[model samples]
Target: MPRLLTRVKSKMSIFAHRKARGMLDGEYGSVFKGRSLDFEDLRAYIPGDEVRDIDWKASARHGSPLIKRYVAVRRQTVLLITDTGRNMAASSLGGEEKKDVAVMALGVVGYLAQRHGDVVGMVCGDGTASRSWPAKAGEAHLERLLRDVNDGTALTSPRSSIVEQLSYVARNYGQRMLLFVVADEVVPDAGMERLLRRLRAQHEILWLTVRDAQLAGPGVPGSANSGPEDRYDVADTRFLPGRLAASEAVIRAYAAAQEQRDGGREAALRRLGIAHVHAGSSHDVVPAVFTLMERHRRGK
Candidate 1:
């Protein structure tokens, strides 16, 4: 095969595999099927109850067991807010750019929501106020929604606060909504705190940080040592754990300090009753969304 053709084929294969895997896991896009109350399971027939939910064949073998199932309830609206500030556009992570990760994560979450029959909307931009699309369900809506995210990221300039934007979204949404914010881990300004506290009174919020691996830890994944011959290697240059490695314990200690700061901010948010999750460069957005969703679902 021609070299270009071979590369294209390889890329196509990877895409196909990823799409298939996502579908198998019941994650295709943002629309999620709401839970229903109809019973779904069945066990061996039991005693002292209604005779409706029994497995006769299994009961025959065991002589007296039973099974039952319930309807799953429908899902509520899911709004994904992403920070496209310059901080996110640049990456300290060794993999994709932080903004790229944010886009992909939003796409995956939107796709899952589309699949599940839930309305998925987005609020995007670098500042407090962003371009908003009201929550809507369906494949077409998801495509349009993702387009906003992709386009919005390019339009956002460096901004220091997200609070103004968050507050605007909170008012527009009004009712309880599942909110997720994909952004960098930079310290929020005072405005951010005020907006978050205000939103706390009305919305369920989750903050997911789409950060680089170097930010998450101190090393690169799947990369070999750098040498004179590899001067141009992106891998060699991308991982800056050296900033920590060179100082020996000091840098590591500093990293720990930063982590503590990050933790404290996160803890403070939680105290106000917000949920937060960190996404590393290597982490796929789909699974992360599901993990957060499952946690929220189970909690309720």
Candidate 2:
């Protein structure tokens, strides 16, 4: 496959001109400001910065307020978390493969972390297996991580299990780091809630959910608003009869169930102080990331 990170940066350059690009770095920096240690330097304060971080004596000497930068904040380990399985190989709500969207989203955040002077790593797996890579600096390392996500995910892969990956990190890793998670729509459960509470106590978490293709409606499962009549299921490799999902009542029920699923996930994450966002396709990743970091920085 072509270089995945190259595609990611090109899109970043395009998004850079769109206003949100420049703000991403500052937003990212602000998110970790509270975790900083050992004073490094100072920069002009922005509106949203916490008042406690300002150096009043320094501000008296200088014309404007300056925010203290810290060594720990400048060299954070950003752990990339994702689910690579049959679920990811399926199509997204934007009519593209979920794996492709995941790669893009992961690459975007990884690139941002790299630019912010942080090391990027990954933890991903299916229901039965999990894998991880150490955090390291450089575009080359970030490229390899993105490539792993792109190449490993397939329709024939094992079932997706983000919980198992979280468990893996909880069991082994002790460092407090930022966890940028990319996964498909997940319904909240008691076990999941327990696991998230545990992880939040150890690491900061950000979740991005790739919107699954909508079935049981007029549109195709993966397509945004249009597609063939039938929906395909990867697990059993069976085609869903269009007549079954074509009913109006069936469509309403499916939509309601999906909403509940979304709300459940949102509430669970919020209760644990984790920030979550939704990306329907590649087009949504950039803005979704911006919104995620904003919420994180503002504690919303």
Candidate 3:
């Protein structure tokens, strides 16, 4: 587990440098602008400075507009909310387990937080049972948190709902936190959407959806196999009848349904002001996370 975390950190280091440069150049956006928790100093108002941050008394005394500058809080909390359901145990097209991809994703975020001096925590569950680690700083604590979740010792049930973890955080974890939710390709349904909305209202939410190639439609270009003889099931391993898989009309309908489901999930997240990225395999996790961060920084 430590070795995997080290590799993920090495890869993320390059991306982190790029992101830091982007933030300084105003290329990324306001994603990291207002997270400070301590007042640093006052300065003459800049054109792009948020008006709400103006120090009224200081401005009056100086006879010019001034802005309150706050130092970036180094001890903020980063929470990894992961789903350990059976679906997440499925294999990806890259031949790596979805669970492994999730761990890699977690490591990328965890390492970044550690570098920023942020306390890292996790809430891992299988719907029926869940385990949570309080926010803590240090590499060793972070490694233990990751190992515990990756080992599946904390997941008490095979059937887990990501919504359950979201609800748990919303109810119990009150501090404003940066939350990274790692889960399988299940789209948000009405119930899940409601839970996510509540959670987003209180925390910064970033979602990573690990894609399952099997969910690709028959007509999808570059899909694993669209051939008539190809056999595939949903990410959850739900089988479609042989006739359905072979029928052109049924294949088209299935593809359309999946598209609609995916679209709805994206729309819901956007409406709730949550950022999300999709990863197709373990190899895609790090890049996808970087992309997600860039988009959020750009306020996309």
lDDT minimum window of 10 residues, candidate 3? 22-31
Top-scoring candidate (TM-score): 2
lDDT of 3 at 159: 73
Once fitted onto the true fold, the runs of candidate 1 whose alpha carbons sit more than 4 angstroms away are 1-75, 154-156, 187-194, 213-246, 298-300
Per-residue lDDT for 1-300 in model 3, tens only?
246677666766666565554342232223456864689999999898899999999999999999988887657788999987766766565656677788888987887777667788999887676779998888788777777766773223377588878888877988888898998766777888888888877777888887764533342334464554444443344656555676778768767887887898789888878888888776687678777887777666
**Cα lDDT, model 1, residue 38:** 58
Clashing pairs in 2: 95-222, 213-221
- Point out the higher-scoring one by lDDT: 1 or 3: 3
lDDT for each of the candidates? 0.58, 0.86, 0.73
Error of 3 at 42 (Å): 3.1
Which regions in candidate 3 have their CA more than 4 angstroms from the true location? 10-31, 56-63, 153-157, 215-237, 241-243
TM-score of 1: 0.62
Predicted candidate 1 versus true structure: per-residue lDDT over 1-300, tens digit per residue = 223223323433455466555442343222223332456776544466556556667777777766665555566677888766555655535455666567666666655555566678777766545777888987667666655554555323656245645866867777667677777765555667777888767666667776544433334444564211111112223433444444456557757877886887776666666656667652455455556655444432
Q: What local lDDT score does residue 39 receive in model 2, on the 0 to 100 scale?
A: 83
Query: For candidate 2, lDDT tens digit of each residue in 1-300?
Result: 679998888877777899844687888887786674678899999999889999988988998999987676458989999999888998888878998899999999999999889999999988888999999999999988988888899988998888889889998789889999898888769998998898888788889999988777777543454533778876457787777678888889999998899888888888888888999889888889989999998787
